[model samples]
Target: MMLEANNNYDKVHFAVLAIGATAKAMHTAPSDIYLRLKKYNLVKELLFDCYDTLHAESIEGVVWNITEALKSRES
Candidate 1:
């Protein structure tokens, strides 16, 4: 349905926002951040899966969460 398609679009949009914000906060390229996230499966597991709760959070909060998530995955 149209609603489901819209929801998917919204989630993807939010994911891109988070990636860019996180890249800025980390002083890295968005593409690098995106690749790391994809490597760790965070793009789907963390971004899309948590879209409902994360979309409501502040950009700073989202960036912190993503940074922490990436750090954790590095271990």
Candidate 2:
């Protein structure tokens, strides 16, 4: 690895070389990280659902046509 991990935090004597030769193991288990990351996609699910609902609506298209006509008249 290019950079070493170190907890030797000191204001005056801090140097990059103080990093440990080996990496410290993560405290959070891999399974926990996987589950949390899986939950993070919940927002994506909601966004896709909204996109589908938007495409299903003819009302917005009607409103858009009226607004576009009004905008054309202003020019």
Candidate 3:
């Protein structure tokens, strides 16, 4: 369950990173990039759901999983 949650976060973060990189390469403003990214707010919500479901064991675990996933993708 935890692994699944992590994977969900990974997928979302990966997409965001890819989009951000593309926007940067295109010389787009970060705000404009974010505006486009906002279309995926639903995806962010779904990721939260996955975290809640898998980390029912502890809120901290869920946060940690998501943080790790985002850090992995961003860095």
User: Which numbered prediction scores highest in lDDT against the true structure?
Assistant: 1
lDDT string, candidate 2, 26-49, tens digits: 244434433432354421332232
For residue 12, give model 2's deviation from the true position in Å. Answer: 80
Residue 21 in candidate 1, Cα distance off native in Å? 0.4
lDDT of 3 by residue, 1-75 (tens): 999888777666754654455456547764554554355452355344453464353434443444454445546
Question: In model 2, which range of ten residues has the least summed lDDT?
Answer: 15-24
Scored by TM-score, the top model is: 1
| Residue range 1-75, candidate 1, lDDT tens digits | 999999999999999999999999898999999999999999999999999999999999999999999899998
Model 3 lDDT, full chain set: 0.51
Q: How would you order the candidates by TM-score, starting with the best? A: 1, 3, 2
| Model 1, residue pairs in steric clash | none
Off by over 4 Å in 2: 1-57
By the lDDT metric, which is better: model 1 or model 3? 1
